[model samples]
Target: MNLSTQQKLEQALQRLAPIHLQVIDDSHLHAGHAGNTGGGHFSVFIVSDAFAGLSLIKRHRLVYDAAAELLPSAIHALSIQAKTPDELK
Candidate 1:
């Protein structure tokens, strides 16, 4: 069975043990865009110890890897904000 996009993303990123995580589906805001072909647009904000000392690009890659299965299929565009808990201060 296929999980919803948000559920899939949450399950995937659980590996990060995020202290804070928010996933917002923004598909309605992009209606009619070429990439909107049924896939959703999402924005993610995450804070996790696993992100400590990682560069922004590395953090993003980690997030992307977690949700790799959703890309170009259930997800069209993703806006991400990944940070270590300490960085949230």
Candidate 2:
């Protein structure tokens, strides 16, 4: 089977060094949603020490950095729940 949305998200996080992560593709729920024309919406649950000492906004910036061009184009909406491993534990 092809990699699921969660798997794809996991891969993204892993590529960025993740301590914890959960990616959920909620595309099915947004059939006619904007940007959902091709790809879909995603909820990213990520926790990593890489986020330590950074503000939430900065953490999101990092995610966007990692996602780069994929954001909004391939991923319509990304509900990012990012945290540091210390916060997760």
User: Per-candidate TM vs. native?
Assistant: 0.90, 0.80
Which one wins on TM-score? 1
Cα lDDT of all candidates, in order?
0.89, 0.77
Write model 1 residue lDDT over 1-89, tens digit each, in one string: 97788888888889999999999888889989774668899999999999888899999999998888888788888899998888878
The sequence of per-residue lDDT tens digits that candidate 2 reaches over residues 1-89 is 78765566567668668866778788888888653547778888887888889998999988978876566557777889888767855
Error of 1 at 22 (Å): 0.4
For residue 79, give model 2's deviation from the true position in Å.
0.3
- Candidate 1, position 77, lDDT: 82
For candidate 2, the per-residue lDDT at 70 reads 68
Off by over 4 Å in 2: 1-6, 34-37
lDDT of 2 at 59: 92
In each prediction, how many residue pairs overlap at the backbone (N, C-alpha, C within less than 3 A)? 0, 0
